[model samples]
Every structure is written in structure tokens, then in C-alpha cells.
Target: MTTSRTVPSVSVTYARNGGSTKSNELGMRVMQERAYEKRGEQYLLIKSPPASGKSRALMFIALDKLANQGLKQAIIVVPEKSIGSSFADEPLSKFGFWTDWTVTPKWNLCNAPGEEGGKVNAVETFLNSDDKVLVCTHATFRFAVDKFGVEAFDNRLIAVDEFHHVSANPNNKLGQHLGEFIARDKVHVVAMTGSYFRGDAEAVLAPHDESRFDTVTYTYYEQLNGYEYLKTLDIGYFFYSGSYADDILSVLDADEKTIVHIPNVNSRESTKDKHREVEHIIDALGEWQGTDPTTGFQLVKTPEGRILKIADLVDDEASKRDKVSAALKDPAQKNNRDHVDIIVALGMAKEGFDWIWCEHALTVGYRASLTEIIQIIGRATRDAKGKTRARFTNLIAEPDASEEAVTEAVNDTLKAIAASLLMEQVLAPRFNFTPKTPQSGPVDGFDYGEGGYDPEKSNVGFNEESGQFQIEIKGLAEPKSKEADRICREDLNEVIAAFVQDKQALERGLFDGEHAGGETLPEELTQVRMGKIVKDKFPELDDEDQEAVRQHAVAALNLTQKAKEIAVTGPDVEKGNTALIDGVRRYAMDVRELDIDLIDRINPFGEAYAILAKTMSEESLKQVAAIISGKRVNLTPDEARELARRAVRFKQERGRLPSVTSPDPWEKRMAEGIAFLARMKAEAENA
Candidate 1:
């Protein structure tokens, strides 16, 4: 039967990073938007799924509140150093006057000489400085007061991120200090949590005494205010818990979630024969099964499963490292996307990681602490679509674990995040958590390109505050047209082509932005010469991205190249290696002689030049899958690869080939089936 070809759409709606409706006017969503809408409340406590855009939501609301007529300043607190700039780098920042107001350990109102009076100085500066300030922490709120004295920060609004840390260890000196400082006021507070917040909020918030503000929380199953952030990962749930794999397939027949039920394998050759079975399984799945939409990567189903320990999985140091490397060859096993769905080891999925459209989570490892568990679960707990959307986080508890215990663990850990945001609601709205004190000497830290990224290569810290977007995005791409026409039109397609061209230009630059889950980062090429502005705004015909440049240079070659392999001929044909070499040579010649008339004709195997590229290598798949009820394109990468192999066999056959399930037999069966159906239809139609 003849099959349909892929129909290309002339226009497409590009996904927006900051979710907006008008396609241009950026606004708040889910939890943060809900919190902002309820501005009259003295305390705004939000329990949102992490990476569900809680940080962005809270930052936007804080900025909005701080910008209101009567507000003075705000404060924010967080655990990670990377989180400090989530608000600082936003283009829609409404806090122009407050840029210098927030106070943090690395950044504060006054400078500390030789680190002397570092904490006390930070507090004193915030208290004494006329500009309203946000007080944040690497150190606890208590430490800030101890260094500067309690009088310095009396009624300031406070925000705590990863809020449970405050109560995680209350007996510490700094904990007591913050506990005491916050006791003086119960106004303007926000504590944010991605996990469900439980436990004694009073002991954590007003540790010095029993003080509690009214609490407010939004979870994934309930609302949409923050749900938009999680739309990509909605299908993430199926594979993680290893539940409903078959159900998912049956329900969404045309659109199925290819579950590479990949178990871990050993990749090391030095390993004993004991673990070979699993090693074979994993090695088989690691090869290029398909190429993705990006066109460069051969998309493979990444094996992501927890391997049981033995004299193998976790035996010796050398073996362990080898085993780890082998197992992680699968993208899903790396706790990364590209693979459909997975439930993996926590050791792999750390912070600052996200997967596009993947927001379901299943935590199985019992050894991890509550904090690590929260981070793991929240990795996929993005905000949802529809009403204040939030992911439906599921905890597959081991029989030994108690519901109360798990809830308590979640509460105790996430409270710090909840506390910091609540503190911001009461004290500083926009980045009120203590802001970073500016570095005095030659500032030295990791340099993240514009927008708070720790640039892959770093020996120096950087601030885009004083730079232009053109300069700030030194290595990142920019839109050539600054085009904002209809979302779907021929003009949009034209601009998208320009968008791809602009992307190629950025790829040639020293700093290059590589796609990650929710964000992008520049790969550092070198530091000898820092890139200034694109001196030539529309730089001259840049050939640095020569491969990306379309040209007629390759038109006159007289050879053609196609994908080659070690063809396993019948037992009679002993010239395997020679035949492979000849096939490759002749294929190259075939590609060289290809007609130059058509520009859009993609050599079915790939570009003729791709045969020699490092990334184009292929072998039998690591995991081979076949589509059941639909087309091959309807199948996954692995399925399509199998179909391609079948088609390749058909192409190579010049004589008799094996006829296990011959076309005539299948056709006869179809004819008989049709005859029976036709008789029934004739009777029914006649009746």
C-alpha cells in the first residue's frame, strides 16, 4: 500500500519561555499570580511544585507589590546562590529604584573590609540605608541580627525559599537570631514551598517564641495560577512510577508514550562475564535509534532504571565507575529527557535540571533524605495548564514508610522556601529577601552569561545590569527581524527561517547557547578576549557558521554517499569487509553525482556529507521497537529505525529474498477478510 508523506506546516506557533496570552504582554501565572491577586492578606504562604515556575511567580508578585504606591522595600531569602538573580535579570523588571535595595551576604548596602563585620555590616547597611531593602541569606536571619544587633532589622518584610531549612536546624545560633528578629512583627510575610508544607509553622517562623501568621498554599491538583509552567511535562507521570505503561499505549493509540523499559547495564569491557546479560541489554539501546526535531542528534531511548547491587552493579570503585558510565549512556538513565519517561536514581537528578513537557515524578530510593527527595520529586512537578495549574505529584511510598512521617518530612524541609516567600510578602516584595551585597575588590565568582547562568566556562563573575541585550546575549541568539506579526502566517515562517539563521550565527560565536530543559546556557569557548557589542550590529556575511550557510559550492561533485554498514551476507559470501568498503565508496560516488537541481531533496539516509561526520555513526539499535496500530512515523525512533532497515533490505534485494510473511500471503489474508466483511456489509446495507 502506498503511504502518505510528511506534510510540512508553513506557519508555527513558537513556544514562549515566559508564558503570555497576547503573545507579547508577559504576565504572572499560577501560584504567584494567585498570591498577587490576594494582596490584602498580611501573610501569603505558597506551597507550589518546584520548577512549576514558583520562583518566577513569586518574583513577579513581589515586584508588583513593591511597586505599589505606599510600599518602601522588601526582603527575600533563598538557599541556592544561583537563585539570587531570577528577578535581577528579568527584562520586565519594575524595580528600577530597588535594584540597589536588596541585601545579601555577597551583596549588601555597606562594604566590609577583609570580611570583618560581614554579617553585622550587611544588617547595619540595610537598616541605615534610605532605600528599602530585601535581606537574604547564605547565613540565617538570626546570624544577620547577631552580627548587627536585633535593633537593626525590626519590622522588615521577610521571604524564605526552601523555607523548611529554618526549622531544619533551629538550635543553631543564627536560627535563634532570625527567630528573634521576626518575633517583633507578623506583617507582610510570604513562605513558598514546591512541596506540601506541614509541621509547626510557628516554631519555624517565630522560633524565638510561638508566633504564626495565617498560611496560604496552592498545590498542583487544585489550581492553575501556576500551572502553565508544567504543561510540557504532563505526560511525565506514566514511565516514572512504572505504572500503566500498557494502559497509556492503549488509550493514546496514535500518540503513544514509548516506554523503553530500560534496565541498567555495565558498559565496561573489563567487567567479568557475570553482568554481561544486562550489559548487552544496555549497549543495545545506546545506539542511534532516531534523529530528533533538532536534526543533529540521533534520538535514542535512554535506559533509566535502578540496577540492583551485586559483585557488579556497585562492587568495586573501578567497576562501579565503569558500570555507572555504561548505564548512564541512556539519556533517560542520565535523569535527562530525549527518552520518553523514566524513574531513576536520585544520585543522577540533581538541581538546575528540567525536561521539556515532563512533569511527573516517582521516587523509589529509600536512602535519600527528605530534602533530596523534595528536589527529586519537584524536578518534574512543574505548574500545569488551565486553572492555576500544578502537577499531580505522587509519592510511591515503600510499605515501611508512614503517611504521617512522609508528610512531616515534606513539611520540615520545604518550610524554608515557604518562609522566605512569606517573609517577602510581609517585608520586602520584590527580591526583598536580603539582597546580595556588591563585591568590592576585583569581583571573582562564576561568570554566568546574561540572566544569572553560571556560564559553562568561568573564571570571572559578570553582571549584565549595565550592558545592552545585544551585548548581554554575546553568545546567545537574537531575532533578526524583531518580528511580531501574526503567530501563524507565511510571514511568521519567513521570520522563523531568519530565526534559524540567527541561531547559526550564535553557534559560530565563542559563547554558544545549548538547549537545556527549561533554559539555555552558553558553552564557553575561551576567555582571552571578551566579546564586546556586535560592533557590526548586522555583522557582515559571517562565514564562521559556514556549514549553516546555504551555498552552491557542493553542486559540481561527481560522487554520491549514503549510510553504509557491515552487511551480513548469506554464509556463502565471505567478503564482508571488502563489500562494506566498496559499498561505502560507491555510495560516496553516487552522492557526488547526484543532480544539483533540487535543493529540498534530503538523501533518505541523510546529507551526503553526513556519512563522514562524527555524529552520523549507526549500528543495530540498542532497543528496537515497532509500531502496532499506526504508521511508522507514528511509531517511536526505535520503531522507525526498524522500518528503515526493512526498507533498506527491500532496496538491496535484486534476487530471491526470505519470505517469512510474504506480501502475497498477507494480501490473500486481507482479501479473505474483506470478502467476509463485504458479505456482511451487503446484507446490512440491503436490509
Candidate 2:
């Protein structure tokens, strides 16, 4: 029986995994209702298991929130365009006053010359409507400055779908984009997803700027806490961390009626690494190898030098959408009989993938996240009749292989599961590809049309005539865009916050309201001050330095000079800001200044070489100096003198000169060094 949770039904049908919505299957009613209602309580997280239906639940909540005065219009930034756009029409259309449009431009516009991207169309449409709801791909929403220009995608109510996608390591462009966008109070957003694989926490938290979320809720798929919604399905899984396919073959050799799934390999080791390990597992199966033990089909018999092949083991290259859609339907795969027994896999076939055929799974990757560990477990929770929960086994290479590390891995996996579950409170309907029909009545009002718009000012409105206050978004780029302004919003607000705290000073004309009296805040000092104030104000804002009013002043300047220098290398803006600040901090208060360029007697290579090459490898320069003097290859004094005084060329030539033309790479380098050295000697002699 399904728990109370209610996830949305795709064109596909879903038997409740385990967790059910507490009441009415909308908005995580039982758990998060109180938190949502109160102010300063917008950060509670909810956990939902795989197939627990979090997407649909969150969709309903988002729709319900649309009715609020705070959320008349909103933007959902779809990480994967295919998944988010699939449900854009119906559930969103339900709000009678809000219009929803998917902003992923349908491909294939060869015939139309004037079309831009889906972003352009969505904005134009939103401008035309009275109540606008925009759903766009991360590309369109995240890269607005480059794609549609800055003015196109600004929205007060915004939701970044599948936030976990932006959580992996490395400097991220999307995370930076979303972080800056979501930091505003006007934008009421919910980051939706079912995967929260952990990376460096500091980097991950830096992007969401968690302080901005009204509520942060978390739930775990394991232990089935707030996400008891997923427990109804018999959760079965196999664990085999650090175990080879060969090891698992040994264990599964005795079983029949099993379906094994594997993913395609990409690395250089792909062809041999895992395959070689399978051979070892086959040998370990001993007497059970290839005897069917059930139908007597001898499916896993090991030949002298061969590995065992389990029945129904296939590799599908398509994404979870196709693999899942197909697995959900066809029972017979690749000449295999209906009802697969054991599923084996790697890579894409691992966690986050849904496969009903899998009754038994081996955690062979040695080390995997807890979310991965549990996702593999949650895979078997389908409640199909006569479908028994598969047994789970973890493959371990050694009896005591760093239990502490394994424990941490499992804990992290569990934490990720909790994160995904909580995220599901908002994922269910949004991931809905196809909506089901109401048995009796017409649901026409379900497709709510946005009522009106003012494209120029991003003026939002819906049911204003009925006393409902709505916000509108302007259609085209303006001379001065809101986003450019919003980028500095936090800094401005913090300074304003400090100003509010000291309102008495403000009324006293703190050096004339418009202008500051103290010499304009030093470029470096402003940043130092701003970062300090902001850190003091919210303490939770991730990327922003929290000094009260200094950050505001720095933001006023188009990024400090230090900030510009750091940008040239392209890293997180805050890192650059910090670097700039640090650099400024290092400058001595009572400083010793030195001129970088001091004219000494020009180097032996003459002033010409000095000017021609400001910087080069020591060896390369030696070659240049040698070439001028002919020191390495004997030359007459007249020859050296002529080469030197005959109007030596002066313009600076960046980088190393042709080191040498020798056939050998190393030889060329050596020869060039000697030649430059000789030239330098000649220039010195002439000097």
C-alpha cells in the first residue's frame, strides 16, 4: 500500500514507491505547512525517496503559492530542458490567473530566418499576457547577459529546478549565475531536485547563498524519516563497494530469472578494466556456473578463458528518460524472456537511474556516495504484485578495508538521500512529462493565461481589476537593466541596513544625502569595509562579504580595479574580490614604492634587444645575445660591430624568438641559448 504522499503521474503510471503526501498530496502538507506559513521559517527541507513522488508534490505547492500576493509571476530555470518543459503546460496552467509557457525553443527552425531563441519568444509572450509564468532552460536563464542580453529574463518569483546539477566540483558558471539571481528578496524561488550528491560543502553552499531561501527543508530516503512516503515499496538493494564484477558473478552464479543492466564505458580502461574483473567472479561461482539452476539454460557457465554472461544483461546508451521509459514498458529485452531476475551495471546505469527489472544490485565501484548507495537500494521499491523486494549485498574487496572511510561514504550517501527527499517536496509535478486526465469534468481553467504586461518596465500584473496585485516584466532590453542593478543589490541593501540602524545620522544630512564628504571611499578600503559589514549583517549570505556600507560603495564602482584584474583570469567573482582586497591590504600604509622599470646601462644585448624583448627565458635571451655578437660562432670584430651599430631594430617583440632551427627539439633550444648569449657579449663589448 502507498504511504500518504502523492507524486504526479506522468504519461507513465506510478505505484507509490513508499512515501505518500501526508494530506491531499500537495505541498508536503503534514510536514512543512507551519514552516511555510510563518516568516523566517522558509528554510526547512523535506526528504522523499525515489518514486516517492516529490516532483508532483512540489509543483502543486508552487501552483498554490502563485495565489499569494508575493508570487503572481515566477521563473523556473530548468537544468535539463527535456524534463522541466515536459510538464509546463497543464499543472502550471491550473492557476486561473497565471499563464505558464515553456521557454526551451523547439529545435528545427531552418525555414524561419527571423527566430531567435525560446528566451525571446517566452519574454515576448509574457509581456503580452496579464499573468506571466516563465519556464526556461538553464542556458536561457543562466546566461541571460550573453544570450538575450541582460534585460530579457528578470523575474520576481524564480525557481531553479534540479539545483543539485550545479553542485559538483570545479568552478561552475551556472551556479554563479543562479547564486547572483536568487539573492534578492523579491524573487521567491524554490530549488527543486532529487539528487544532492555532496562535494566540497563550502563551494556548494556558496552558490545557493542559503541565507536567501525563505525555508530550507531536508529529508532522507534512507531511514525513511520525513520521507516515510517511500517506505511502502519494499526497499531492496545489493551493496558491493570495492568489489569487482568478477566477485558479484561468484555470488549470482547460483541464481536464475535475473536481469542485469550495464552502461557503456568511456575511459581508456573501459574495454578491459571491469571485464577482466568479471572473469575472476565467474571462476569464484564454482559449481553454479552456467547450470541455470532454474530453467537449466546454462546462462552463466565460464569457459576455460571466458567470463560468465548473465541473462537479460544489456547496455543502453540513452538517458534515464529512454532507458526508464523502455524498462517501464517492455518485459522482454533483446531475446531475453519476460521478468528479469538480477541486474548488473556500471557508469550511467548506476544510482539516479530507475530500473524495475533490477531485483539485485552489487555496489562494485568500491567507494560511492550514500545517495548512490541508497538510490541503488531505492531502485527495488516498486510495489508490483508478486514482485518481491530484491535482496541486497555489498561487495567488499577486503574484510577490513578502511571501515571509517566506508562509513563516511555511506553517511554522505544518506545525507544526499535526505537532501533529495527534501528537494522532492518541490520536484514531483515539475518532472511530470505527461499529465493525467480528470475522470469527470473539464479542467480548462487549468491552463491559466497571464493577464497583462508592460514590456518596457517589466511591470507585472494579474487580476488587478479584481484587487489582486501582480508584477509585470518588460519585454525588451532597456538602456539601464534591472539585473545590472540587482548584481549590486545585496551590497546596496546592507549599506542601507546600516543606514537604517543609524537613521539619526541619515536625517542629519550625513554630508549631504547624495554625496559623501570623506575623500571617495578608497577602492580597496571600500571593499574591506563592505565585506566586513555584510558578514556582520546576514552572516549567512555566502558570496557577499558582509561589511555594512563599504560593500555598497564598492558595488557602486564597476567592480574595483583589483576585481577587474582578477576577472581577466575568470574565477568566482568573490575570490577575485578577495584577491583584490588582499592585494590592497598588503600595500604598506606608509609605503615604500619602487619603479618597476629602472634604466641601467642597457644589457650587453644593447638597448635595442632590451626594448625588443622585455621578457624571455634566460636561455632564449642568451641565444639572442650570441646571435648579435657571433661569440658562439666566431665572427670578425667588424662583423659584430656592423650587426650592432647598423640601426638595430627597436620595437618590442613579445615572447621568445625562434630559439633555433635545428632538426631536434632539444638541440634547437640549446643552440638558441648559446647564440643569444654570444649576442649579449658583443653588445656588452660595444657598450
Candidate 3:
């Protein structure tokens, strides 16, 4: 399978320190602004993308906490030695910060040579001192906590970088120590990470612990969109049947600044010959000249007779590593793309290794983890002076002979493609919702006064105001005058909520489960079953209101089916463009070019609104309209029943009455539910 798609980049403006401040790194400024806003809080978790200025954001906040706040000291913990450089000495005050960020030479434990005991000793040395800030690797901190105990960290703020390294599993040493610290309540923590989601599906933190954190999430879309220079990033996969080493240059340009990652040695496709792979790429480029003595970059003459310099990061020789490292790090080589035409890496250069001039990240073979894919892509995302766009291409080998292997390969590829699709949404600018004025004719899917929302009318619209797509929900009918009102009036959420919350009902309604009357339902949610479920869920609603919701519900389900067919199956069945490998057809599509207009035409709120709109009814719509208009609605018996059910469930689970003042949406819902129930109960007692 081979395909390509443009990664959409959106631009943004952000305020720093509550004042409008412009900087070269828009991602940094945005994070700084958010951190500055939450500086008063004890624990701050910044979830951001790679190269999104998370490290610098931590520096800004930690410095403030140590100097201005009553925090005694700060410690920056990193996962690896390579990543420790991110926290190296920086002149923050020069960049408009209040103070400079420094890690004393002796206290910086990254390059410190020692066993666990030596690391422990160095940690104790730093802890006993009155130093404002200290930097160390994760292993050093783990040993220090075990050797000296958690008591040593009291009154200190622990800023953990690459926060995802700590897992919820009790056996994860770092996580265990973190749990102890949280339990003590003496230490303040700032968790930072480019990738927060665990690839292994393990919880990053326990639920109760995660709740206490004041999280500031900055997405990839915000970072890339706000870039001063970087505009587009194209990610795609190229499939081949032969050895990747022989076919790599077909997709990778030798003239471009590129990093070529050789397959893992343990994998079946691995040649176990990094030198051989390098030789192949070198031969494909042209004749290799002897290495340059002044800068260890190997010079190669291309077929066009162009001289290209290549850095071999996979070489095991110490002397070669030193010379190459020096050449790559030399100030003269910075932003000089011609000097480093290609970097051949086996395992290094995935994270925290900065090469601002890199324009192409070409990897040989599949990366099973999505987190790694994002990290590898980060290598080429840095804002370079002249570079406007970057590209990531994966050259994967097609699966051979075995049927099981073929199935696995196809499934993994499909999953990767799906992930890329979702990532595009994550990195794209969010749509802003607004109330649509009642139209004389049909507008974007909605017809005012008729309570009609057609899925076919939905679409993705680019707005000049926000420089992003706007999801236009047309129509102003029934009561409330807001986009959410249209969603509620249709009961889109209600139908979805009912089926989702009840597995048996969902199976019966959508997946052919046995009914009470012994009638067998269809394997999929048909229009007939949808109507019945919608009616059953809203017994209190009148026929007219119920009918409108039912129609919307059916429309939503139909639209979902249509989308699945068009997006997933249509291309394969219609175009016959899929490749047959080991008897399994591998479908390739450029997900980045997905028709957002087509996706937009379908209302996400249709089914959900259909569910919620049922019970909402005419009178309930008035109550909702009143709420939207900032007017209060006195509780009635039916309203009371809905509120009571949710409230009782909340109290039963938590062993206490849910707070009416809680800012949590679920808690507020439960409180309202219970309030209505209480009112109805009171009326019943009087009767």
C-alpha cells in the first residue's frame, strides 16, 4: 500500500503572562501563558506535543515557584541521558523571563559516572544543599528515593519531564514513589510530557490522583499552526516487496536533509547490517569520497555529480561517534542543510535530538507504536529559518506467504491509517459553534421552525475569521436559540446515551439480540429498531416531540452507516485499487485528504439529540430555552423524575450527596436530577 496526504497546519496567536507578547516559538508562548495562568495551583500537568515547548514552559513555572512562591527548591527529572540536555543551562532572563535557569555542574547527574550507589550519593548531596534547582535522570531519582526515603523530598517541587514514563502499575518504580509523594502531600509536582497517552494502554495515573491535577493541554494542531516558519508536514507510507535497503532511495531524496532509520535488529526484516544499509544508500546516492578530516562528514558524489555529506549515527566506533557528533553539533553546521545531506540512524535520534534543518524523516519498516511515530515526526517539525514544510515517509515491506501474518499486517496498517486520520483532527483547528438564525430555506442541515436537521446537509466550512473550519448547524426552531439547543431539541445525545449506557439495549437495538417478545432483531441498528428504542426511552414525551426526535435518530444512524460505507468500503469495492498480498486486500487511502465537507454534512448531535430531545419535549424545550436565555424554570414532577434518577445513582455510588456547587458537568447534572426528584417527592407527600 502506498499513499500520501498533506498535514494541515493552522496558525495561532497567544498572550503570555496575561499580556500580549509575540515570540518566535508560538508553542512556547502559548504554554507559558497557560502555565502562568495556573501558577497559583500546586500541581500542574502540561500535556503537549513534541517540540511544543513543554521543557521551556516547565522552566518558566519552576523558576517562578522557587523564587516568588514559598516553594523551597525544585528538581527536574528526565527519562534518558539524551533528554537531560533539554533542561541544560538556559539564559531565560534574556528571553524576557524573570530569572535565569541554571543547573550547577556538580548537581547535574546526567553525565555523572556511577553505579546506583553513586547516583544515590549524588542525589543526597543535591538534596542536602540549599540549591534552588537540580537536574537528574529518572534512574537517579528512583534510587535516591529508595536510598534516602521520600522524606528527603519534603517541601520540594518535583518537576518530572516525559511524565508518561510513570505508569499506574504499582510495580513501576517511578510511579510508586510518585504515589508516596502525593500521599504525603508535602511535595508539589509539575508533570510535563510531549506524549501523555500510554501506548501500552496502561493508565498514566490512578483516576483519583489524575482528578486532583490542574491540566493544561496544548495540542499538535495549536503548535504546528502557530509555527513561525513550518507550514506543512506530509506523513505517508510506501510499500515494497524487496529489501528496503535496496529500495529506500526510491522514496527518499539524497539531496534533502534526511534521517534514515534502519529496521530493528531483532525484527525479521533487519539485515543485522547497519553498515550494509548505509553502503546501499551511499551507493544509490553516488560514488563515496574519503571522509573529511576537518569535519567527519562523509562526502558522496551523486549521479548528477553533486557532493553530499552523510552522518553515520549507527556506527559503534567511539572515534567515529565523537568526530560525527562534533561535526553535527558545530555552530557552523547549524541550519546548513548541505553539510548533512543524510543521517543514518539505527536506534538514536527519535526524541530530544535536535536538528533544526532536517526536512525529511524517512524510516524503514513499521513502527507499532503511535507515540513513537509522533516522536519521530517531531524531528522534522522544529521551526527552521528558511524551511516552510517537512515530510515523513515510512517504507514498509509487504507481508508474504502466511495468511495469519497477512491478516496481522493488514490490521496493523489499517489501525495506523485510522490513527493518522484521528491525529489530523487532533492537530487541526477546532470548530467554533454559534447559534444559526432561522432561515427561510434550508441552511447547513437544519430547517428552522420545522425542527428538521438533515444529516446530508452537514459539512466542514473554512472561516476567514478563525482561519479554521466552522461546523455550521443550521436552523433556529422550537425554543432555545443556540447550537446546543438544536442538538438537545433533536434528542441526538439521548438515543446514544441510552444505547451506550445499556449494553443489552445496545445489542438488541443495533446488534441483533433477543427481544422480550422472542423477536430476533437485525445485526445492525435498522430504522425500525431505532424508532422503538427512541419511543421506549421517552415515555413521558408527547407524540409530536417524540416523532421529531425519532426521525433525527434514524437519520443519524443512517448517516453513520453511509459514512462507514463511503469512507471505509466504497473506495475498495468501487475502485478496486487495493493490493492483494497473501490473499488479503490492503487498502491504501490518503486520510489527510478526507472530505471534511462530506463528514461535516452528517450531524454528530443527531442521534444524541434524538435521545435527549425525547424527554425534553415542548414544555421541557421551554425550560431549556429559559436556561439558555438565563431565565430559571421552576421544577415540575416529570423534570423532577429525570433529576432524581441521576442523583440517586450518584449518591449510591459515592456514599454522599453530590454537591450542587460542583463545577464538574456530571456532578452538576446529578445535582439537578436529584433536586427535581426531591421536589416531586415533596409534592407526593403533600398529596
Top-lDDT structure, candidate number:
3
* Candidate 3, 3-55: lDDT as tens digits: 22222211112211221123533223765677767876787888777776778
lDDT of 2 by residue, 1-687 (tens): 111111111011122333334443223433334333432222322233454444444444555566554455656566544445333344334433243333333321111235347555645566446554566566656545354433344444556655655642436767655555555334455665444333222233452364444433333322232232222222212223333453355435345333333323532112345544434444454433443444222234334533333432232424433444345334244233343334445543443344544545544422334334445555554333344434333432221223544333333222322222222221211100011122222122121123322222222121211111121111111112332223233223223333222312211122111222221112112222233444454444443223212333332221222222332234433341123222222221112321111001001112112211222233433433332233222334433332232112111222343345857433343344456557778899999
lDDT of 1 by residue, 512-621 (tens): 11211111111111100011111121133242212111211111111111212212222312442123223322332334322222211222112211211221112101
Better of 1 and 3 by TM-score: 3
The C-alpha TM-scores of every prediction are 0.36, 0.41, 0.65
Which candidate, 2 or 3, would have the higher TM-score against the true structure?
Answer: 3
Compared with the true structure, all predictions reach lDDT values of 0.32, 0.35, 0.59
- In terms of lDDT, the poorest run of 10 residues in model 2 is 595-604
Q: What is the alpha-carbon lDDT of model 2 when measured against the actual structure?
A: 0.35
Alpha-carbon runs more than 4 Å astray in model 1? 1-26, 40-42, 64-72, 93-142, 168-175, 198-212, 224-356, 359-364, 367-374, 383-687
